[model samples]
Target chain A: GAGVSQSPSNKVTEKGKDVELRCDPISGHTALYWYRQSLGQGLEFLIYFQGNSAPDKSGLPSDRFSAERTGGSVSTLTIQRTQQEDSAVYLCASSLEGGAPLHFGNGTRLTVT
Target chain B: DQQVKQNSPSLSVQEGRISILNCDYTNSMFDYFLWYKKYPAEGPTFLISISSIKDKNEDGRFTVFLNKSAKHLSLHIVPSQPGDSAVYFCAATPGGYNTDKLIFGTGTRLQVFP
Candidate 1:
């Protein structure tokens, strides 16, 4: 409740309907990340969580994308079908356990129509 | 084939004058480097870091310069203000400190005029 908190900040969904983006991290900060930013482009690493285990989803770009995290402090990123280039702006970050300055969340602006 | 590159999409500093942002990486196995500062809706916010075994890294006035054999990296924001403008991202990680898959760049919109 003091940083990284993402949620339905904005979601338009429709193309195929199937979206889920949520992240809440900052409590103990054990590492959690999920990046996206289409439109102008850049920040696109797609998965990271060291507590719920995701050694590295290798930037989940396909497989319809999927992400998960649990007791380590909530995380979720699912996109089953939505297309429209899959919109963008998912972003969510957290750090501390291994540390190197990371603390973001003000994302979730998906919008696939 | 973008292995991190901020080919200057925008930059127009003035305020205090001194804002150079540039980043280029072709992945030489990277080695931890970061500089993020976004605005608009707000998200990125971590401004200095450089570690390719060290080329340069400062804080206060914000400085980060690493040119590992030309993999290049630059971020200097000496006096530039006006709230430091906005977008400016350059991140890379070959696992360092707390690496977690990062390799971004394509942001550089500093516009501190005034």
Candidate 2:
């Protein structure tokens, strides 16, 4: 791909429903990251996957938030029993390697109603 | 706590003038800082970056200044143009070979008027 690609650019789900956001990183990129941006707020780290290494999930806000990267290329972020507070933009980014500049996707705007 | 902070929510500047955006961090361990520019409905793109070892880094019309003692960093755009209007984010990563997670500041919206 020319750049990182994220699916479902906008999503409106009811509270308690489950939602999934997908990201397809650039070809051959070795690192992937997920972040959340609330209204008028900064980007909050969620999780990161580097190559075949175990992902760093320290930044996930709660147990309901989880992510998985398969084959180190495509990734999915799942939110279970979503809450109103979860309404925000979910962003995905990738870099050639850790410490490199990230290339980002436009993001999926998740609205929990 | 907000480890990274951009106190000013917005900034306006006239075309041909310099536009300065400020950011402050409380974490002294941060070793790399970066600036990103974003337009509505689009993702942020990397603008410029500076390592803690250096006080300044410049690329074309963009420059980043870091003051380690003060825990402050700023991005300056020379001769601002209307097309430069967008939300600017300041981000920092802790010292290490793995710089995956970046702490970002609340963005500053810069409006360059012609």
Candidate 3:
């Protein structure tokens, strides 16, 4: 796709259930990022992948959250035993290279009941 | 600790006027900054950016000014139009890139009235 694309525009799940969000970045973009915005809060970083380097997971809120980017194109963020507090709009973005302006996907709005 | 903050939650401006959005950061290590615009239910769109090497950058109707000493930055949109109404976010990183992650402000909602 010409722009970053995210699947399941909206997801509604019960607490304690597992959920997976997917992202397909712009073709040839080397950097992909995951962020979430809770109600009335700023965008919180979740994970980042650049090329073949190890992803920086420092921004992940808890151990229940994890992500992986396969072949440097598509990425998935998984939330385990989701709690109500884990609910947020999950956003994905990609840039041509490091330090470049990012192109973003519409985002997946995850709701935990 | 919140590293980035947008003190104002909302602002209203008449069409064809100038709209100024402010942001403050506490991380002195940050060298890059960017502005993003978002409409409801959509992802943020990159608007403009400025590196620490320069204090000001302008692109057509948009301009970004940085005050390194005060750790503050402001985005100016000239001749604001109704279509410009949206939530604006300021983000920063140590290297001013997207490698690690960007610290983001809470966001300011700007409404341009006709």
Candidate 4:
């Protein structure tokens, strides 16, 4: 891909429902990251996957938030029993390697009604 | 606690003038800082960055200044253009070995007017 790609640019889900956001990182990118931004807030790191290493999940806000990267290429973020407070933009980024400049996707705007 | 802070929520500047956005951090361990610009409905784009070892870094019309003592960093845009209007975020990382996660400030909305 020319750049990082995210699916379901916009999502409106009811509270307690589950939602999934997908990210297809730039081809050959060795590092991938997930972040979320609330209204008028900064980017909040959620998780990171580097090559075949164990993912760093220390930043996940709660147990309901989880992510998986398959074959080190595509990734998915799943939110279970979403809450109203979960309404925000979920962003995904990729870099050539750790400590490199990140390239971001437009993001998935989730509206929990 | 917020490790990074952008006290000013917004800034306005005239085209052809300089636009300065400030950021402060509480973590002294941060070794790398970056600036990002984002427009509505679009993802943030990397602007410029500076390593802790250097106090200043310039690229074309953009410059980043870091003051390690005060835990402060700023991004300056010379001859600001209307197209430069967007939300700017300051990010930092504790760049030792493979420390990739970035801590970001809330952001400052810069409006460059003609």
Query: What tier of docking accuracy does candidate 3 attain?
Result: medium
Q: Give the lowest summed-lDDT range of ten residues in model 1 chain A.
A: A47-56
Clashing pairs in 1: none
- Cα deviation in Å at residue A38, candidate 2? 0.2
Which sections of candidate 4 miss by over 4 Å? Answer: B96-98
Docking class of 4: medium
Q: Model 2 over residues B23-100: C-alpha lDDT tens digits? A: 999998998999999899888899998899999999999999999999999999998999999999999999543687
User: What is the TM-score ranking, best to worst?
Assistant: 4, 2, 3, 1
List the candidates' TM-scores in order. 0.34, 0.97, 0.97, 0.98
lDDT of model 3 at position A43: 93
RMSD of each: 14.6, 1.1, 1.2, 1.1
Clashing pairs in 3: none
lDDT (10s digit) by residue, model 1, range A27-112: 89898888899989988888777865545788888999898787788888999988999898889888977467788888988889
Which tens-of-lDDT digit does each residue in B1-114 have in candidate 1? 899999989999899889989899998998998999999877898878887999998989888989899999899989998998999999998888667667789898989989
User: Measured against the native two-chain assembly using Cα atoms, what DockQ does each of the candidate structures obtain, in the order listed?
Assistant: 0.31, 0.76, 0.71, 0.72
Off by over 4 Å in 3: none
| True-vs-predicted CA distance for residue B11, candidate 2, Å | 0.2
Given the true complex, what DockQ would model 1 score? 0.31
DockQ of predicted model 3:
0.71
Q: What local lDDT does model 1 show for residue B44?
A: 91
lDDT of 3 by residue, A1-113 (tens): 37899999999999999999999999988999999999989999888899999998988999999999999999999999999998899999998776557788999999999
- Highest lDDT against the true fold, candidate: 4
